[model samples]
Target: MAAELMDGKLLAQEMKEELKAQVEELKSKGITPGLGVILVGDNPASKSYVTSKEKACERIGIFSDDTRLPDTITEEELLSHVDRMNRDDKIHGILVQLPLPKHIDEDKIINAISPDKDVDGFHPVSVGRMVLGQETFLPCTPHGCLKLLERYDVETEGAEVVVIGRSNIVGKPVANLLMRKDKPGNSTVTVCHTRTKKEDLLTHTKKADIIIVASGFPNTLTADMVKDGVVVIDVGINRVEDASRERGYRLIGDADFDSLKEKCSKITPVPGGVGPMTITMLLFNTVQSARNRLSK
Candidate 1:
């Protein structure tokens, strides 16, 4: 049988419904969870992402504060905006949309966001806490990947899992996350990066019961690399040229979905798979931040 499609759109909707109820409860206590998003430059993709987050916030009764700046904004000026958001009592979570203008220092900007309000979980403090297995805001994409595994009932306990890619965003955090002694964790994980030899990568992946690919390239995993009965969660979203499509391009995952589907027991599709989960998890962190604020 072909792999059972792990439907992320359906899962995200379910999560949003839960969040909606939580928001109603918070409102009764006169506390509204708020999210502040800072978008730099006019990148169409970034704008689309920010818009989706805003819509999601609206749906869940979370307040949205958006700041759209030009590519010419200075690093200092951008940091000022981040600082302002940090002090906004109503804003429980602050997210600086990534890939800021080339001139801006990403590390400095991420470090500027208060760890308590770092909903994106890119802040150095948050990343450190995650590495130490402490309670911190988990990065949205990685958290989403973990949640997908849990909701689908894929057993990770003692599972030999291979993670392709080692970037901070999806790969590094996820590799560390899955190795922790937690319900969705407790797996032996091997992370393959650019330095890993191709033969070695396939060797590890073939032995894996779960394969998570975040390498930003197409065909990073094929049937030959992963064995049958493996669970595949693809995090890459690369656009390839397509003549038939209206946009002249189509989105694709790292794995050769068509070829790998027949071999894997479960798989997540691009666009609808990890993408929606990422946004939903961001909302999750936002709500959690508000909840944490009350406890403090």
Candidate 2:
């Protein structure tokens, strides 16, 4: 039998409904949660992502501000924008879209956002707080992955979870989350990256009860590499050639879903899987930030 679908789209819709209600409550209290997105270049992918974020905010009754700058924008100018958002009382959350131009320092821009308003959770402060398991804003993608596991009722406590990819955003933070001593956490976590030997990758992944692949390469995880009855979460979003599609390409995950689904107990599809949850978590974080500011 095929594995059960994780259904991130459905879960995201449910979470959005909760956020919508919370937003209504906040509005009744005279606080409107606001998210500010700064897009520094003309990268098509970045633009599309930002557009999606804006629509999500509108759907959930949160206010959104979009700041678009040219590719030639200087680091100083970018910092200035971030400073403005930081001082804006109405803006509870600030997001600087990633893959900034080569001349700009990504870290500098990320650190510029106030920790309280760093809804993307990319700042060093947020990373440190998350490592300590504090109540700081969690990274959206990894947090969404955890939410997927919880919504699906997948066993995580004491389970061996092998996460492929070691980037600061998804892999590392996710490993930290799973290892935390919490209900949705407490899994024995092992993280693998490019330098890891093939044998080592297969060794850990094959024995894992849960596997999360976010390495960004399409079809990186093969069916044989995973053990039967495992729960697989493919976080990678890669665009590959597809002549049939209108866009001439399609989004795909790192795992070979067709083969892996047959052997796994549960799996998440690429387009509808972690993608929707990421945006939902952003709204969730923005709401939390607004609440924090209001309480202060």
Q: Local error of candidate 1 at 90, Å?
A: 0.4
User: TM-score for each prediction?
Assistant: 0.98, 0.98
Which residue pairs in model 2 clash with each other?
none
Model 1 steric clash pairs: none
- Per-residue lDDT, model 2, residue 204, is 95
**C-alpha local distance difference test of each model:** 0.93, 0.94
Candidate 2: global Cα-lDDT? 0.94
Q: Candidate 1's C-alpha lDDT?
A: 0.93
**lDDT (Cα, tens digit) per residue for candidate 1, span 157-270:** 999999999998989999999999987999999999889998899789999999999999999999988888999999999999999999999999999999989999999998
Which consecutive 10 residues in model 2 have the weakest lDDT in total?
Answer: 214-223
